[model samples]
Every structure is written in structure tokens, then in C-alpha cells.
Target: MPVEPDPTRRSHESWRAILDATFELLEEGGYESVTMGAIAARAGVGRQTLYRWWPSKAAVVFEVFLDKTNIGPFLAGGEDFPTQLRAFAHGFRTLYVEGPAGTRLRELTGAAQTDPDLARAMAEQWFEPRRAPVRQALQEAQKAGVVRIDIAPDTALDLVFAPMHYRLLVSGGPVDAEYVDAIVDLALAALAPGATPA
Candidate 1:
């Protein structure tokens, strides 16, 4: 008798193909161009397969963004909190300034304004999880006396990340290394343990 293929391995392969196809389509033609049918065709899987995994094109695309743009490695840089933060900022700046991923993010940001479900999915899947590690790092810094204990980790994270988002979504300013460094410097100064007002 012929040996049977492993269902788990096959399922993993199929999922990878679907995600890869979704990104390829997104890079090729923006958000409006991607559809379940197109992703299935590109992945060489059936439409039923795509639908079985994701309810919509936005769902598929969001999963791809989460998998592809994980900032974990970026957050693990340098010898100290300030250095690590600067590295993270540079990584974030580069991601948004230099790839199809940025285009996809911008599309999603605009779509989220009109689609509450998409907005919730992004917040729950992408935003919260990504921020968790950053928050943990901040907490650790505070414990080590490098960061101010009084300020919430969420506030510190906002100070570090908000400028990048503003530049990406609103101001349309340059997110170059210099700009990223400046943001990191300002954030570090504010987050320093003794910087709080008396």
C-alpha cells in the first residue's frame, strides 16, 4: 500500500500558499485587487480552501501582515532600553517606508474607518499583540530603574510609536533614520526615571 501524506503537514503547506498568494496579490494591485477567488487561483488551491480558512479578503490580508511584519526581532536589539527602542523605531520606519507591506497597511487603515469588523480584527490581532512585547519591555525597564515608574507602559509606547504612525498616516513626512533617532531620543528623555516633574 502507498504511504499516506500527513494531513497536518499538508494543511500547513496549504495555509502558507494561501498567505503567500494573498501578499503577492496585495503587492501587485493593492487591497481592492485582492479577492478570495484570486488568492485561491494564485495559491493553486480551491476557493473552498481559502474560505475555509478565512471569511474574507481582509481577513486573509491581515493574517499575512501579522505573520510577515512581526516586530519581535526588532525589539530585541542593543544593550539597553534606549538602544533597543531606537532599533525598534528604525525597524518600524523601514517597514513602512520601503515595501508593499506599507501600502497594504495604508489600505487597511483607510478601510477600517468604514468597516468596524475590520477595525476590530486589526486592533485585536495586530495592534494588541504587537504592543504586548513592547509593554513588557517597558515594564522591565521601569523595574530596572531606567524608565520612569509612574508613567504607564502604554503611554510610553504611544510616545515612541505615535510619531511613526502620524508620519505614515497623516503628516506624510519623512521617516528617515534621523527622524527615527530623534523620536527615540525624545521618548527616552521623557521616559527617564528622574525626568518627571516635582
Candidate 2:
């Protein structure tokens, strides 16, 4: 028996279907192999629908990257910002270190080196959103007089995240728990007044 399509499902089905197809294509064939026609056919959607939603394949793939990964540690739950920040760090390390998606991330980031548009979109859409929670946590830390207010939030974010990106993209080293703890400690130290590096 044919399953009756749910109307609510139909409304957002195309978007979900598209992302699902993107993941499949990415896993099976990598970023270079993904094309609009292939994605549309995989999703069972029309080319017009795909074009209407995403201006380019890069945008579609970026969205799929966001959807498949947990951006922050906590999912907007009951924990305080700091606790959630810790959780977010843990989650981030898990994905960046051991997850299957890490390889795809490396490849896409490599491709972004030549593709300016993808690089911009990846930074704006994928990277910025991931940092938002840490930004909030830093703000909270400032209000509590734990973090020096002189340092800008963006700077704080960079201090905390830049190392991980450097390791992931450039150094090609392992992202272990010890590394995460060291990163958190160093970033926090920079934000502390009269704090000297040990």
C-alpha cells in the first residue's frame, strides 16, 4: 500500500528531502560529485524547486552540514550558559575529532580556499552560528566579573575557537580532551585581568 503523504510533511518535505540527498551524495561521492540535478533527482523534487530554495549547490551543502551536526553543546535546555558552554565544547570536540563528518568538513574547507563564495557562506552561515553560544557565554562571564570586559566578544571567540580550527585545518593533529581543556583554560586566562601566561 502506498503511504499517504502528510500535508505538513509535504510543506517542508522538499527541504528535508534535499538535505537528505545532499548527505547521501556527500558520503558516497564527496563534495565535487554533488550537482543540482543529482540532488534534485535524489530528493524526488524538481530542479525548479531546488533552484527556488538554494541559489547554488554550495548553499544547499552548507545547510546540510549545519543540519547534520549539533552546533552547540546544549540544545537550549535547562543548564546555565557556562554549563552549556562546556557541553558545547564536548560536543564540538566529538564531532571535530572522531565523527565521519570531519573528513567532509576538511574537504569542503579545502575546496573553500578556491571558492570565495563558499568560503564566505561557510563562515557566515556555518561558522558564525556555532560561535554564537560561546559569545553569549563570554558575555555572561563578563557580567559576572569573571572575564575582563576590555576584551571584545569576537576576540574572545577567536581565542577559544581559532586553535581548534588551526589544528583541524592546518596542523592535522588529534583533538583530544586534554587539548580541549588546555584551550578552555588558555582562552579563559586571556579574559582574566592581570593574568599572566604560565
Candidate 3:
């Protein structure tokens, strides 16, 4: 069902209205319930308007999450990679592992397993851009001799963050600071130059 949205909203206001309406529909039901017609009706925008900006329903839904979600890890990288990594991990915890967004993530993850468009849209529109800064930070650390060059930054990110995703999606484990620290500790130690085998 389309929620009541200000039909008069336009331009940037229309954009916000579109996203807001998408979020409302998501809350009212779930991923399955959100449709282009409902979104257009709710936002008082034409279906073409949504298509003008985003390719699909999943794309529009992802946009709402991106728009509402916090801009993560204020300090992109730091002199202390460990500290930076901790903050980054915590940022992920807060954004994708903890609350409403986290719940959406878990839901969409399962949803994506079936809907190829959603899978592709989530990865391309949502995950790819966000991963860049963190990857750049890792690359810089590697160049600075702070991180081992042998491991790719992408792989490092996966290693550092996979457990958080696992906890949120698979294991249903706690993603507290302690768990983050444990993952960081093990990951950094492995990624340290001249590191010894345990």
C-alpha cells in the first residue's frame, strides 16, 4: 500500500519524498511488498521518475538505505591502522550489523539470493562505492609499510569484515567491541609485515 506522501513535493524534495516513501513501504511490509507502483503513488512521483534515477525497485530501496544510513568512519585512515580499523569495524557494526539498517541488510541478503537484480544492484550501487575509501586506506597503509603488501586490500577488507557480516547474517553472534577487537587483532597480526606464524 502506498503511504500518504506530500504529492506537491518536487525536485530534491521529490527525491527525498521518493526515498522516504520507499522506507515507509519497507517498514509497513518488507522487501516483497515494495513495488514501483506503490513507491510512485506514495511519493507522488511518476514511475518514470524513479526509473530516471534508479534502474529498479531494489535500486530505489537501496538508495533509501544509503540516504538514511550514517556516513561511516569519519576518520578514513589514521597513523595507527589498528585504531582506524577498529573505528571502521565499529562503523560497520553500527550501520550494517546492529539496528534497522542491519535488519534490512539481513533481509535483503536473503532476498538477493533469489532476486538477481537486487543482488547486482546492492553490490554495484551500495557496496562497491562504499568499499573504495576503506580499500584506499588499506592500500596507503601497505605503501607506508604499515600493512603487508602480500594481501590485497580487497581481501583484507573481506577478512576484517566478513565476521561482522557472518555475525549479523549467519551465526547470529554478538558483534560487540570485544568481537571486533578479536577480529582486528587476528587480522592485523596476520597482515603485519615480517609476521611470525602462530
Q: Pick the candidate with the highest TM-score.
A: 1
Give the Cα error of residue 173 in candidate 1, in Å: 1.1
Off by over 4 Å in 2: 1-16, 44-52, 73-85, 111-120, 196-198
Q: What does candidate 3's lDDT look like per residue over 1-198, in tens digits?
A: 112234564377788888889999999998889999999999998998888777778667766776676555434544577777777787777776556887777777777887898898778756776677778888888999988998778888898888888778788888888888899898988889987556
Instruction: Write the residue-wise lDDT of candidate 2 on 5-54 in tens digits.
Output: 34653447777788899899998998889999999999998999888766
Best-matching candidate per lDDT: 1
Q: Model 1 Cα RMSD, Å? A: 5.4
Question: Each prediction's Cα RMSD?
Answer: 5.4, 5.6, 5.2
Candidate 2 overall lDDT versus native: 0.74
Of 1 and 2, the candidate ahead on TM-score is 1
Model 1: runs farther than 4 Å from truth?
1-17, 40-53, 67-73
Candidates in order, TM-scores: namely 0.77, 0.72, 0.76
Query: Where is model 3 more than 4 Å wrong at Cα?
Result: 1-17, 44-56, 73-77, 196-198
Across 68-177, the per-residue lDDT of candidate 1 in tens digits comes to: 77543377744677777776778777767777767777878877887788899888776676667668887888999989999888889899789889988989888889
